[model samples]
Target: MQEPPLRELRCDVAVIGAGTAGMAAYRAAREAGARAVLIEAGPGGSTCARVGCMPSKLLITAAKAAHDARRAGEFGVATGPIRVDGVATLQRVRRERDRFVAGVLSEFEKFPNEDRVNGRARFVARDILVLEDRDTRIAFGAAVIAAGSSPAVPELLAGLGDRVLTTDTLFEIPDLPRSLAVIGGGPVGIEIAQAMARLGVAVTLLDGGHALAGLRDPDLVARANALFAAEMTLHFGTKVERAESAGDGIRLTWAGKDGAGGSGVFDRVLAAAGRPPSLRGLGLEEAGLSLDEKGGPCFDPRTLMGEGAPIFVAGDAAASRPVLHEAARQGRIAGRNAAALVRSGPTGIATPAPWVNLAMVFTDPGTAAVGETYDPERAAERVVGAVDFSRQGRARIMDRAAGALRIYADRAGCLTGAEMLCPEAEHLGHLLAMAIQDGQTAQDLRDRPFYHPTVEEGLVTALTRIIDGLDAR
Candidate 1:
């Protein structure tokens, strides 16, 4: 059976953006027996596969290899004069990044040609979208805006030409810069700054705020900040006031909050400030949908319905939770509810319980915050148990002993949240997330089997402290 031509067509649901959330919504809508069309603008690939997570991790892996080799002597293994070939290192990153993107493209191929449109979509009316590139108008019964985000380059760095880089442009560089100034204290900036520093680049990280990687606990933040400062120069509560062309490089002048200021010349300046939702020029107002302060759709987070209209928003466009898994969940919910609105009209749908909140930073001693993280307002009701991995048995065995873990519980010992700056914190974070979601107590987690002389033993030690704290109360 042949589908109708694109000159004039109506879809039960029209999904904008071909990234992670958009793709999921399109497939989900079809599975719900709705006629859906997936729209994209030119080049198609997820931010993670193309530039964000995959490529950054590749670079970090190479840096870790170099760092480990340099420290092998402490483990009684001699690795003499470890050298990193910057060109070869980045070439491999690009090579592997292409393969990951190819995998995402393969998923795109599964959708039929008639169901995919290649153009930027803008809403002309509540039920109508115009593809600006081809002048094609599509009428949709319901819609999902999963359009992702873009790097927010600071106004100060705009005129520096190619000397400036963002995560989107960082991987494409042919070689590592001799000196780098990373202008952000967020995850992307911290991860890339440390990676470049470890890979023999002189890195200076500048942030206007004092927080490091979103850790609320001052102790953990201090620990992580000290660990990162040991490798790269960090300036917090400071802003870059000026940038200009220098002889073969760029010069940046920065001012501290306390009236202190300095200047430096660097081969490149990375604008890791932030990634705002890519919502400009989408004509969202024309669709009768209001936007939030962040320029994202004002919608119900659970149903993803837009302000009582027949529209939905997911992924970065929602500007709520930008994580990939969260985006995929929102996309699924939006698609299903859109189909339901078309078929049965907005009733009898059971919204799932809220998801567990988890976040991780892939730095040397990884950092993670899971579930109900530390809050000063709730401090009186919470008991915190902490363990320093510096003394943990397995940490000493592996010579990777440099971080701490803290678990939080209420007076009754029910696990509430956990934060860590520890080696292999990713695994520990996941374990804690599951326990918190299941309403497990500190005593319950302590009873769980922990293999001897492993990083996980540190978790057991922390759980025991929580139980002890509970008993004391």
Candidate 2:
């Protein structure tokens, strides 16, 4: 059978972004027997699979290797000067990213019910979308907004031009900076700072607020700070007064704690301050959707629906904190729930579940958390226990003693949250997420047999400490 022409094309579900969340939703919709289509504004690639997560992790891997080589002297192995070919390394990173994205695109092409449209999509009506390239309009029974975010660039520093780069553009620079100043201490900023410092860049990390504010645990912050202090210069609770063009670099003036001022010259400056969801050009308002106070689409969390019927929001486009994993999870639920509502009615399937077990991964020493941290005043009084990775034998063997594991539980012993800082923290994060999501107690994990002499043993030890402390209490 021959497919209909592009002009007459329509789908059961239309997803407006082809990033992680959009791809997940497209796949889910196909699995649920809906004809699905994905639209991407990016240049046939995704931020995560391209310049965002994948390239950043590649840089981190090279940095880690260099760091380990420098420490090889501890094992009585003599080494000469360490060299990093930044340009060549970046080329290799791009090649790897291209290959990965190609593989993903190939797999997506295998879906019989799914189609990929390469262009920007804007809402033409409640059920209609207009593609940018041709005069093509698509109508669908349901639509998902998964458009992800782009780096936020301050207008004041726009004059720096190529000298100042956002996360998306920084990786494309031809040469590595001899001295780099990162203007934000969030995950992207700190991760890039440490990775560059390890690669022999004189790196400085500046944050307007206390660094890592999302991390509520002071001990985890202290441990991360110690590692960063050894690797790079850190300026916290500071604001950039101005940035001026210099001979070959740029000069930055900043004010620090209690009106203290300082100046620095840097070869390059990366603005990793944050990202705002890509909401423009979507004609959201034209479709009757109103922006929330934070300037995102107002959504009903229960239905993932926008102001009007049949239009749903998901991923970064929705009024939710942006994270790749969370976006994908929400996209799956939203896609499924959207299909159910359109197919069998609102009661066909339960409402999309609220997000939980959101995990964040920072490459250096890594970190992962689920549920909520225990704050005496902020959180209902609960039982909390934290154990240092220095006490874990596996961490000792790995020579990574700078880590922490924490668990939070209620009076009934049901686990509420777990956080870990160690090698494979991302992997361990999922395990902890399961415990929190399933309402399992710390004792339940402690009693479960784990493989001996592995990183997982740290979890067992941490859980045991929680059990012992509870017994003593």
Q: Quote each prediction's TM-score.
A: 0.97, 0.92
Worst 10 residues of 1 by lDDT: 345-354
| Candidates' C-alpha lDDT | 0.89, 0.78
Best by lDDT: 1
Candidate 1 local distance difference test against the native: 0.89
lDDT of 2 by residue, 179-275 (tens): 9999988878888888899988999888887745255577777777777788889888899989999998989999987788788999999998887
Superposed by TM-score, candidate 1 places the C-alpha of residue 116 at a distance from the truth, in angstroms, of 0.8
**TM-score: model 1 vs. ground truth:** 0.97
Q: After superposition, which runs of candidate 1 have C-alpha atoms over 4 Å from their true positions? A: 1-6, 348-350
Q: Give per-residue CA lDDT, model 1, range 267-372, as digits (tens).
A: 9999998888888888888998977776567887778899846899988888888888888888888888888788787782347777889998899899899988
Worst-scoring 10-residue span by lDDT in model 2: 373-382
TM-score of candidate 2 versus the correct structure, residues matched by position: 0.92
